[model samples]
Target: MTVTSAPETYPETYSAGAYWGARKESPEDCARRTAGFLNLLAECDPFLSHWYTPARSRRDARKHPLMPPDVATLAELFRRGMNREPGGPAIEELGFRFSFDNGGATGDCATLRINGGMSSEAVPNHCVLNVPWRGPNADRLLTAAVLTKAVRAMVLSWEPDWALAGSSAYKMQYPEPDSAPFSLGWITYLSRRIGTVPPLPAPVRIEPVEDRGTLIILTPERFTVANPEHVALARRVRELLVQAGLMQ
Candidate 1:
C-alpha cells in the first residue's frame, strides 16, 4: 500500500453537533453491526465474499465535501436515498469495515459504497466506485455493467424492501489511492510520502457557485470538472442542475 497524504486532516474526534447528524456507534458495536450487514450481503450474492471496513477509508470519508454542507439539503438527500429521515439511532455513514466487493474473492474491485447516509446528494442516489490502477481485476472491472451490479447489491444489503432508486446512474471514481494526489496535486500526498505524481487533472467535481467563485469538489459521483472559473461557469451550473432535476 502506497502512503497517502492527509488530503485534509479532519479533527480526529468530531465535536458533538446535530449539524451532520450524530456519530453514536461505538467502535465495537459499529464493528458488530458491520459484520451483520456483510453477512446479509452474502445472501444477496455468493460472490459478495469477504467484507471488512478499512479504518483509513472511514476516516477519509468523514471529510467528504458534501458532508452536512447544509443540514436541510443533506436531510433531503438522505430521505431520498434511505427512504427515511436522518436523526435517531439508525446510521450516519455505513463503512462496512471496507467490505466493498461482490466480484468474487480476487479483490478485483476498487471501492464499494452504499447510500447509508441520510442524504443521497445530487446524483439521484450517491455511489463512490474506485478502480485501483494496479489491481488484478483492473482490466475486467472497466465496464459499467460490473459496477452497476455492485451498486445494486449495495442497495439491497441495506434496503432489501425498497425499490432501487437512480438505477440508470451510478456515481463512480477511478482513484489510484496508493499513489494519487487527489485535489490536483495541491496536497501532494503521494509526492510527500512516496515519489509518485498522481495523474491529473484529478477526478474532482467542480462548479461555480453563484458569485462564490468556482468550487472544486471530489464528490461521490457526478461532475468531475477541475478548477472551473466562477464567472464563466456558475450560470451553466444552474442550468445543468435543472436539467439533472437537482434544482428548480
Candidate 2:
C-alpha cells in the first residue's frame, strides 16, 4: 500500500495524558492481550500465519522515527519467540508473542512471531496502517475492514472495544497532533464491511479544565457475534477449553 502524507491542515489538539487516561487497556497490557487474542484468531483463520513475523532491523534504526515504546517491546518479544526462547513467560495462554516497534512513523508497527514456520513462502506481516485523514474516507474504512477481516480470519474471531483516536471530534479533547486517523476510519469502514452497524454509544463530551481536557467516558458495546455455521466449531472449542478447565 502507498503511504500517504499527513494533511497540511491536520489540526493539532492531541494530549498524551488525555489519550492514555481514556484507554481502558494500558499499552503494555494491550500488547500482551492483543498477542493472545491474535493467537486464538490463528486457530480459526488460515491467513494469520501469512501476516505475522519476527524479524528486526538494527540498521538505520536511528533514521526511523522513535517507535512507540510498547510497540518496540512487543517486537522484541516476537524476535525472542522466533528464536524459541522463553520470551516473557507467555503472558496469556494463547501462545501469542507480540511486540511493536516505532520505525519512526506516526502509525505503530507490530511483529508477531510464530513457531515452526507454518508456510514456506509466507512473508512476515510488516505493513503498518496509518490513520491519517486525506484519502477517500471510504477507502480508509475498506482498508480497516481488510485488516480486521484478516485478523478475524487468521487469528481470533472475537471483537474488542475500539475508540477513534484522531478524529477532529476526539482531537478536541485529546489533541494528538501526530496521531493517525486510521483507527477512526477503520471503525467507519468496518461497520459498513460487516453489513451491520453496531449501535454506538453517544459521543462523550470533553470539557476543558485547567488547560487540560476532561473526558466524559461512555459505555462501549461488545462486537462479538456467532453464526450457525460456526456453531459446531465454537462449541467444540468451548468443550475442549472446559475439559481442559483452562478458563482464566
Candidate 3:
C-alpha cells in the first residue's frame, strides 16, 4: 500500500485588471496597446520585467522573448488569437486574446492576459495582471504605491472603463453586490465617463490620472482581509463611492 499527500496550496495571489466595453479596433491597434502596456509594466517592478510568448509548453514558451515588444510580432500573435466559432469561421464581433508571462522563479513570475478589439457591446474587453504571492520579492513588490502605479499604467494604456488592483481573496470574500457597477479594491480607477469621484474619508485619498479618470487608494499599505480594520475601511469607502454615483 502507498500513501500520497497533495501539495500544499498557497493563498490566492493579488491581481490588477482593466475592463472596458466594446471598441472596434484592428489587430495592429491591439498590438500597439499591448506593446505600450508591456513597456509600462516593466517599469513597475523588476519582477514584471522579463516576458515570453506562449507556446505548447512552458519550456518552449520560455524560448521566445516578448520584451522589447515588436509591433509586427504582437500583431501576428493577436491575429492568431482571434475568436473563432467551434470548427467554423472567425467570430468577427468577438475579439482577440493573448497571454504572456515573465518566465522565471515561481515567486517572481507574473502573467498578463489581454482581450481587446471587440466590436460587440456584449463582449467586454479586458486586461488582467496576475501577481505572485510566495516569491522573495512578493512582499516588497506588493505595496500600495507600486500597485497603484500598476493600476494607473493600465488606465493610461487601455483607457478602460474601470481598473482595480488588490488581493483575490479579499475580493472574493467582500464581493460587491450585483447592483454595484464595479468592485472595490486596494486601488480603483474610475473613468470620467463613469462620474466624478466624491470626497472620501481620511486615509482614503483620490488623485486624477491625467484627465482620463480618478485613482482611489484605500490605504497606504498592503490591504489584508486578515485585518478587520482594513475590511471595515474598504466597506465604508465603497458605500460612499456608490452613493456618489461612481459605482452605479
Candidate 4:
C-alpha cells in the first residue's frame, strides 16, 4: 500500500497525553489546573468561548452514568494545560498525545492522536457524532444531550436487535470535520458518554486511503447498529445547534 505521510501546517492544540505528561497532582489540584487552562483558552481563542459554559453538577453527572467525572476533569485540564507549560502534573496521566504533523503538501499543522492510534491526520475542521442504539427512549435521551451541546452537524445511524442476546445495542462515530477545536470538543464529549474517556485508544484505525483522504477501520462488535434511540439523539443534536446559532 502507498502510505501517504501526514501533512504539515497543523496547529498545536493540547491533547490528553500531553496533560498526562504535565505532572501528577491530586484530583482537586488537577481540577483547578484545568479550570485555569480553560480560562486562558477563552482569552487566546474566541471560538472556544462556547465551551466555557458551567460544568454539569454531580447530580447531573450521575444522570449520565456512562460519563465519568474524569472526563470533565480532563476537559478542564485541557483548558489550563494549553495556557501554560507542562507543570504541576504530567501529560501522560491525562491520556492524550498532542503533536504536529503535516497533511502531506497541504501545509504544516498539528494532529491529535489517541493511544498511539493512527497519528492524527490533521486538525479536524468539523465533527459529527452518530449514536446508533436500540430502543427509542434511550436514543431520544442521548439525542437530547447532543442537541443541548449544540453540535454543528451529526448523523444518527440506528440498528435494532444488535446484541442478539435478546436485547438491542448501539454505537457511535463522530466523523471528523474541518472545525479543529470544536471537533476536539465533540470527541471528548462523546467519548465520555460511551464510557470511553481520554487515555483510551480510539478503538479504530485511521488509515490514509488516497490523496488526502482516510479510511477508519472498526471491529465488527463496534460497527454493529444495535440502537435507534442514539441515532435519533444525534439528529436532534444537529437541530439543536441550528437553533442555538452554533451551526449554519
Predicted structure with the largest lDDT when compared to the true one: 3
Instruction: Tell me the spans in candidate 3 whose CA falls farther than 4 Å from its real position.
Output: 1-10
Of candidate 1, the 10-residue stretch with the lowest lDDT total is 11-20
Q: Which candidate is the best by TM-score?
A: 3
User: Candidate 3 lDDT, tens digit per residue, 215-247?
Assistant: 999999888888889899998998888788776
Higher-scoring candidate on TM-score, 1 or 3: 3
- Cα lDDT of candidate 1 equals 0.30
lDDT string, candidate 4, 37-101, tens digits: 33433332232222312224534433332111244644443444332234555433333322212
TM-score for each candidate, following the candidate numbering: 0.28, 0.24, 0.93, 0.21
Q: Give me the displacement of residue 227 in model 4, in angstroms.
A: 1.1
Instruction: Report, for all candidates in order, the number of backbone clashes.
Output: 10, 22, 1, 59
Per-residue CA lDDT of model 2 for 1-248, tens digit only, reads 99999877543221001011122223344455445544543443233222322235534443443222235565455444442336434332222333333232332222332222112222222212222223343233223323444333222211212222222333243232343211321122221111222233243222222222112222122111122322233234324323443221
How much RMSD separates candidate 4 from the native structure?
A: 20.0
Residue pairs in clash, model 3: 107-135
True-structure RMSD, every candidate: 17.5, 18.6, 3.1, 20.0
Write down the lDDT of every candidate, Cα atoms only: 0.30, 0.29, 0.87, 0.27
* True-structure lDDT of candidate 4: 0.27
Score residue 232 of candidate 3 by CA lDDT: 94
lDDT of 2 at 44: 32
Which sections of candidate 4 miss by over 4 Å? 1-176, 180-225
